[model samples]
Every structure is written in C-alpha cells, then in structure tokens.
Target: MIKDEIFFKNREVAAYRLLDVLPIQQMKLEDWIVISSSFGGYSIAKIIADTLDAKLDIMFSDKIVAPSNDECDIAIVTEQEEVLIHEELVKCFDISLDYIYEQSKKNYENNILSLINDFRHGNPLENIKYKNVLIVDEGINTGLTMMACIKTAISLGAKSVSVATPILPSASVQTIESIADDLYYVEKLDHFIGIDFYYDTLEEIEFEDIKKINKGLN
Candidate 1:
C-alpha cells in the first residue's frame, strides 16, 4: 500500500507533472477536443484542458451502447473504457462477434489495425480534419489499448497522434512510443501495479454528468 503522506503530497506534484512530460508542441490545446472515461483520467484531463485552455468532452462508456464518434480535434480515454470503445466499434462496424474475438487474440500491436479498419468500414464521416490528435489515459500497462486509440485517431485522418498519461509501466511506454508521434507520462514506477494505486479519489462518473459537461462546453 502507498503511504498516505507520499500519496497526498504527490497529488499536487502529479497534477502538474503531466504538463512537463507532454510534447506541448504537438498539442494545440485550443484546437483539440479532450475525451475521458474514467474518473481519474477525466479529472486529470480536466486539469490539462484548463491549463491548455482547450475544450473538454466527457463520455461514459457504460451509457454509450453504440460508438458515437463526435467531431473533435482529439480523443482521450481511460484504460477501463477501452473495452467499451471496442464494444462500440463492434456495434458501429457491424462486425460479427466471432470476428472480434478472433481478432482480439492477436497481439495488441495488430489490435489497433483492427479498430481502424473497423472504423473505416463502419463510420464514414465526411469533411473531418484533425491535424493533431492526442489520447490521454490515467496509466498504461500493456500499451495495446493506447496503440488502438492512436490507430483509430490516425485512421480518422489525424496528421499526428500522441498520448498522455499520469503514470505508465516502462514496458508499456516503449510500446506506445513505437506507434505514437509523441508520448507523455508523469511517473514511470518500476513496480507499477495499476493506476488506482496512485490516486486518492477514484470516483465513477455518470453518463448524464458527462453529457452535461459536454453540453456546457458547446
């Protein structure tokens, strides 16, 4: 267990630490859209958005039975919401469950390609232009999901895709670097277990609340 003092004192440090690791050049906060799923990720994204003076978009995967890709400059999500994103992809793409299961068996490296191909065939939006896209998550363990997120953004026509996280496992960071144009991580714990270990307040956000936040932003 993390010591209380270490954890509490680190909160403020962790808050601003994200900005230091992020490749600010690729992130024109004013022009990008930020999406977050988990409470931890959303909280951090909110801070980052405020710091960058960018628009924030929030979505609860539980309520979104279908994949609703909105018009935004960037997309950010938490690790837990990845499964929901995949589910939405399945429904939006009209792919068979058998195909999804089979494709999921492959390494995460290829899983990203699957999501992009699925998006291409499923939702074909017009006049979508995202010069820079960034996906923010609380932490990354395998990096596969991040890759998939990056793949989806690039497939949607983002010129450059980047990732930001509060904390990430070293191995996962390496994997993300391979696919992302830029990567930012606040902490690289040697024995990282999960994102929850680093946060004091990890709450569950409701879909209505997310919708409300989105509405206010618009």
Candidate 2:
C-alpha cells in the first residue's frame, strides 16, 4: 500500500520536475488544441493550454459520441473513466448491471478509435492543420490507448506525436516509448495501483456533468 503522505509529496515533486523538463511552449493560441474529458485530465489540459497560450478544445467521449473530423493542431484526451457510474443508477432498484459495464467498455474503445480516425483524416477544427498533434492523458497503465492515439495521429499525417501523462506505470512507460516521439510523465512508480491512488481528490465524473460541460464549451 502506498502511503498517502509519500505519494502526494512525490507527485508534487514530479509535477514541477516534469514542467521543468518539458517546458510549456510559448506558442500562439491558434497553434494548439486541447482535447480533454470531464475529469482531472481536462483541468490539467486547460491549464497547460493556458500556459502555452494555445487554443483549448475540450472533447468528451460521452458528449461527442462520434469522433471529430475537424482540423486541429494538437489533440489531448483525458483517459476515459473506467468506473461506470451509470451502473449505480441502474442498480439502485436492483436492475441487472452486468451488461452495462461491458457495453460501456465497448463504447469507450469505439469512441477512441473513431477519434483517431478523425485525426488521421485531417478532420479537426477549421483553420487548424491537424499536423504535429499531441495526445495528452491523465495517466497510462498498459499504454494500449496511448498507442492507439499515436497510430491515429500518424495516420492523420501529424509531423510528430507526443504523449503527456501526469503519472504512468513503469511497464506502461516502456510500451509507450516504442511508439511515441516524445513522452512526459510526472511519476514512474513500479507498482502503480491506479491513477487515483496518487491524487488526493479523486471523484467520479457523471455523464450529466459531462454533457453540461460540453454544452457550455459549445
């Protein structure tokens, strides 16, 4: 078990260290696209985009069921949440919840693939080139999703693809290294229990909240 004090301390150190190593670029707002989900990753992406004076484009898997074919310069995705909160609502009255998890998982995977295809096809925000795309997630575990994002970016003719995650499992780092041109991670723990294990305030993002945020952004 990871000690809370030690974990947060290390995370703080890691965050600053990563910022130092991968300094935010002083680029125009038009040059960057921030694609993120409903949770912490979204918050982080927003901050990073602000630091770089880049345009922020928030994308949620739940809101935009289909991938975007718009032109964008950079794309960041908050790793989709694993826990299905909708299951709780169904189970409140003792509804069968077994299939919900499976279906949600399938939807998540499909959405990811679709987004990749959209990027590959040069469909990003209008006026944005969609080349030199960067994929940002909160954390990486197996690196499967990161690899998928990279492949999609490459197919879309992105000049380079970089991955930035706040934390990553050591094994996952190796897997990401094979495909990504550059990688920025805050922490490299050998026995990563879960991404939430490092954060002090981890909470579930409701689908309704996601919808509201997307609507606001639009």
Candidate 3:
C-alpha cells in the first residue's frame, strides 16, 4: 500500500531525488540528451540536465482527448507527427482511427507546432540520432504523453530512451517499463490523487519563465 503523504516538497526537491537513481555516472554526458514533456517540466529537466551535463530540449507534443470526454486522453501526438493511441481506451469507446488521425493532425499543427515556435523558434529538434535520451516530467498521469515522446525519440534514431519523474500511478509502471529503457521515479502510488497533491509547492510555470530558461541553456 502506498503511503498517504506528500512525497516531494517541490519539483526541485523531486529532481534532486531522481538524480540519486539516474545512471549519470555511467553516461558520457555528450552522448545523452534530456527532453522535457511539458513547459512545467523544464524546471525539473534543467536540474537533471545540469547534473548529467547533457543538453536539454522540450518534446513538442499534446494529448488527443475523446470527443465526449475531455478528460479522457485517447492518444498522443508530437510535432514530428509521431502518434501513440491508447488501444484499450479506443476499443472500449469504439473510437474510429479516422477520428484519431484527424485529431492527431489537428493537435500537431495547432498545439505542438505552436510550442515549437514559442520555445525553439520553430527550429527542428536537436539531432538525437544514436544518442541516449532521458525524458523528464514533473509527473506522469496517463503516460500517453511520455509514451509518445519515447516513440518519437526512437523514430528519430535515439539509441536508447529512458524516463524520469517525481511520481506516477502504480498502474502505469509496467506499461512504461516495457517501452522505455529505464524508469526513474520517487514514488509509485497505488491510488494517485493527482500530481499536484504529492507536492507542497507545485506552481504552474509561466511562459516567460520557460523562455528565460531556454535562453539560459543556450
């Protein structure tokens, strides 16, 4: 049973804890890249990337929600046009592939592309071909976003893909393990109460702050 208590005081605290388990010592640093799953993740990713001495980037991606339920994410899509649908959810709802594709295209062009332009000035993602990738997020809820990031990284020739997060739903552990090369997390809860519940000071990162972080990295 998972404990009923806050796991991290803040995202920075979680980042430091994750560094304890990440295999940074074995990595050459130059051969690895750190990618954030969201703008909020940049703070967490910055800490990890600084520790690993690796380049940091953001995965321009978004989730495709079901038509009837906005909370139900049916699939994930990246700016690179990579997609990963939740087959079980789609089947359970009898959702059509045509709808998924349509949503995927819309998400790519509308959401992901906007993020790429805002954060990266519309430049293509850094060359990660043959490089080990470590994807960081403050937390994972459905895991669809992270899964899509893994797929996109692999499709772009990432030699190996790993993930790091502060907390995740216990149910998602096995699925994430099967796809990524490694998973580093502080807590895996049997009953997830939402990512913010586990942190004492989880604030939404501002757009300007994220751009500042990007500039500092460059």
lDDT of 2 by residue, 84-154 (tens): 23233344534344444554466556674455344323244322246455566666655544565565455
lDDT for each residue of candidate 3 in 1-218, tens digit (9 for 90 to 100): 24548888888899999888777788753588899988778899999888878899888777888999998999988879998999999999999999999999988887778877877788999889998999999999888888888889989999999999989999989999998999999889998878888888898887787888777675
* Candidates arranged by TM-score, highest first: 3, 1, 2
Which residue pairs show backbone clashes in model 3? none
Per residue, candidate 1 scores C-alpha lDDT tens digits across 1-218 of 54752332333456577878765555653366554434346556766776766655432222222223332112223212233234545555575655443433332234333332343332222222565555676666645456655665566676676778878777787767887887777677777676666676544554344444444443
Pick by TM-score: which candidate is best?
Answer: 3
Backbone clashes in each candidate structure, one number apiece? 0, 9, 0
Order by lDDT, highest first: 3, 1, 2
Clashing pairs in 1: none
> Which residue pairs come into collision in candidate 2?
35-76, 69-123, 69-124, 70-123, 70-124, 70-125, 71-124, 71-125, 120-156
What TM-score would candidate 3 get against the native? Answer: 0.93
**Every model's TM-score:** 0.60, 0.58, 0.93
* Alpha-carbon runs more than 4 Å astray in model 3: 1-4, 28-30
Q: What's the TM for model 1? A: 0.60
Query: Candidate 2, overall lDDT?
Result: 0.51
